[model samples]
Target: MYIFSGDFAFLEIWYVSSSIPNMLVNILSESKTITFSGCFLQFYFFFSLGTTECFFLSVMAYDRYLAICRPLHYPSIMTAKFCMILFCVCCVSGFLCYPVPIVLISQLPFCGPNIIDQIVCDPGTLLALACVPAPSTELICYTFNSMTIFGLFLSILGSYTLVLRAVLRVPSGTGRTKAFSTCTSHLMVVSLFYGSLMVMFVSPTSRNPAEMQKIVTLVYSAVPLLLNLFIYGLRNKDMKDALKKVLRL
Candidate 1:
């Protein structure tokens, strides 16, 4: 759990950092303009980080399942070496999935009115700005996003489902309660993330209103990142005790 938490903490930092600084600048600047290269760079990093986050969340769920459901074998199965491999796999897979769609979108011709209705470089918004229709491009982007979002989400559900079964089998109510408590924080974070993520990216052609898109994007991209500190950190007994000590000091 600590290994996964360390990876998650690093991911959350980069995930939020990728776009928030630029977003803050956009808020303060008069022109509210970003260069073509800048926009795509932001888009790539932001989405890549997001994709990485999905994998991390899924892995964390699997880790919890192993710990709870297969406690006897967990130490052997989830060694430091195995954890490092999982970390590498998540990062590589996350960064690799988006390049094809991003490249496809970047190749599209944008003649004029180069304004994007989104706060960030969203694929749907970028596609909308293209000079000609790009139904194929749109389909490709939608397929990639859907596969990543839904695939990882289902994996999480599967892990938790198994974990739930194991918890139910615990004969003692206290044991069941303890097992449920271990998973509750992770489940909350997953809910906060995937709820808005699915709405926004599952079917990009839904063409939600610009304001609506911004709101949803903020919910998934920024809100969960902020809430995770509370969900994972403050919710931990050690962290809470440390906080109380600091407060008293």
Candidate 2:
């Protein structure tokens, strides 16, 4: 819950796929060919998975805050059933939200050049390939972008604010420090994931900023994926200890 889970998933898939362009741009610069189904899968998966990830992470953050700030009732407040419901809610809700945008995107017709500016599959880029008859394409893009950015931003902001308040309540130097150690990693991941996304898309795409935009693209999409596992997955002492114990067995 510290970071948005849906965007996190989008970022993960985005970065991994995005990195390929950096290494292979020479041979694949303008080769922007994607099957109709491939196009749907890219956007559908990114948006759907990203939404689930965002909501799920928020739930996790709340769970952590409960554990740390309200230890006495943390179990009752956030039980296995509660967590399972959250997971299911995120998955089902994320998937269901796709029908409208998918239908909108599907109605467009593709009949001209199909050069995607950056690598990977961009919903906007794919929509641009739609023939002029598809007047609703731009509306779909704007709608998707607006809904996602707004929903994600508000969700993240509220969750982090609660988390910050919880962190502030830890007394004693060691207690505060230990609380930070747990919170810091998730905070960093959250910042990196959302920060990159906002920076990449908020501004109008311009030819003059083409070079800068490309670099930003790499940062927003690639660096975070590589960093998340290192910072959150491996760096936590408990995770390290668990790995070591498992290895010893």
User: Per-prediction TM-score, please?
Assistant: 0.95, 0.73
Summarize candidate 2's per-residue lDDT along 78-176 as a digit string, tens digits: 766776677688778777777777777777767767555655455555665777645455566656666676676676567667767777776677887
Give the residue spans of candidate 2 off by over 4 A.
1-32, 133-136, 202-222, 238-249
* Whole-model lDDT values for every prediction: 0.90, 0.63
lDDT of 1 by residue, 1-249 (tens): 878888898998998888888889889999889999999998999999999999989999999999999999999999989998999999999999888988999999999899887778989889999999999989988888898899999999999899988898999999999899889889999998999888898856556778999899888878887888888898678999999999999
Best by TM-score: 1
Error of 2 at 182 (Å): 2.0
Off by over 4 Å in 1: 245-249
